[model samples]
Target: MIERRLFEFHFANGDKNGVYHAVYAYRNPDGGFGHGMEPDTASPESQPLFSIMALETLDEVGYLTKEIILNDFMPYFQSVTTEKGGIPWMFRPKSDYPCEGHFKTVKEWAALSTTAPLLGILEKYEIDIPWMKKAEQFVWSEFERIKDKHVFCYLCVPRWLTFLKYTKNQDKAEETINNLKKWILVDGIVCKDKADEGWGLYGKPHSLNYATSPESILHSLFNKETITSDLKELVNKQKDDGRWDTWYGISEGTKLEWAGIQTLWALKVLNNYGEIEK
Candidate 1:
């Protein structure tokens, strides 16, 4: 239902309300979202990861309003937030529904990987609420702590990039991007060649996965040839059934759900780079 609505919204001149309705079905009474909205876990309990997916969907459909941010999202985040004012990647699932083992093993501590992206979403929408300041503080501290590290987690790089992309502190953001460049493609943080593997959920992080759009600050890290090749690689990955597949999922249901999500993502990326008509 969600995937079909997303397809229609993007490609078939469909109504955004349909997408909103389907996504809202996952909203918990606590104002957070769950029930496997992310596809990697089927836990019905409200989780930070699921809420991130939910917010991303809402943002895509232009349904993320200031009211939604202040009333629905902030309260839920406050309830789950750590003392450091950041949310954990996952909370221990209260229900026994299927969940990946890695998600089950997470400790209830603040994680920049999850928190930074949420902040990025808020930044992108220019939505400022009281809770955002604390999140920003925590994310900045994490960035400072990790800047000198020899390597970075592949997953965190894009989230951090998203935060930097929309962050108000352009000077600091530029400095951080420059500092991180040495480790980005050089330390194998991002995949420059097509053969690099095992560095991401499905494979190594493609150049497109980092830069996302031509205007993104991360685009400076890749050459024209690299982006062009990665674009071709992305286009070739689509299956005969007109959907993209995910290599990481704990269940058959999860795989199918992720396929739909990935298909939507692929279409958006192609359209962003003008590989296809929007």
Candidate 2:
């Protein structure tokens, strides 16, 4: 339903409100999202990661208004934030619906992976609220701590890059980018080769995942030849059934759900690079 609405909005001249209504079904009373909006977790309880998915959807349709952020999302974020002003990847779900084993457990630490992306999304929309200030502090502090570190997770690379992209401090962001560049494709932060297992899977962040659009700051990290090759590979990844496949092993139901979302994402990325026909 969500993918259908998104397809309509993007390709079939459908009303953006349709997308909103479909996504709103996932919203909890707490203003955060759950109920399998993220597909990995069927838990009805609100989660920070699910909220990121919600915010991304809202932003895609230009429905992420300041009012919504303040009245809905901010309150939920405030409620779950850790002492370090960052949210956890997941909280223990109140109701036990089907969820991945990792998400089923409580994540006690404040995670930069989730928090940076949230901050980056807010920064992308240029929306300001008091809660963001604290999040910004936490994200920046983490960035500083990890700048010199050799081992950084692939999942966190794009999230941190997104934060750096829209951050107010261009000088520091650029420096951080330069510092991190040495480790990006070098230290397994990005899967440069297609032969790598789970190369484009959920956990493996790749060059295209980092750059996304041609206009992205991360685009500078890869040369035109590399980008072109990646784009061609991306185009060829489409299956005969008109969907992309996720290498991550999941249930059939979850796989179908992910296929829809992945198809939507592929179209968007292709459109961004002028690969889509009018």
Provide the TM-score for each candidate, comma-separated: 0.88, 0.88
**What's model 2's TM-score?**
0.88
- For candidate 1, the lDDT comes to 0.79
Give the clashing residue pairs of candidate 1, or none.
Answer: none
Candidate achieving the largest lDDT:
1
| lDDT to native, each model | 0.79, 0.78
lDDT of 1 by residue, 1-278 (tens): 88889889888999989988998899999988888877767788888877877777778788888778778787888888888989998887877888788777889899887898888878887887788888889988988886745334545677777788888988988888887776666755565555543322444666777677898767888899988988888887778999877776787877888878778878887888999954
Candidate 2 C-alpha lDDT tens digits along 83-144: 89899888877776877777656666787878988888778768877888888888889877
Q: How many pairs of residues collide in each model? A: 0, 0
10 residues in a row with least lDDT, candidate 1 = 194-203
Residue 113 alpha-carbon offset, candidate 2, angstroms: 2.6
lDDT of 2: 0.78
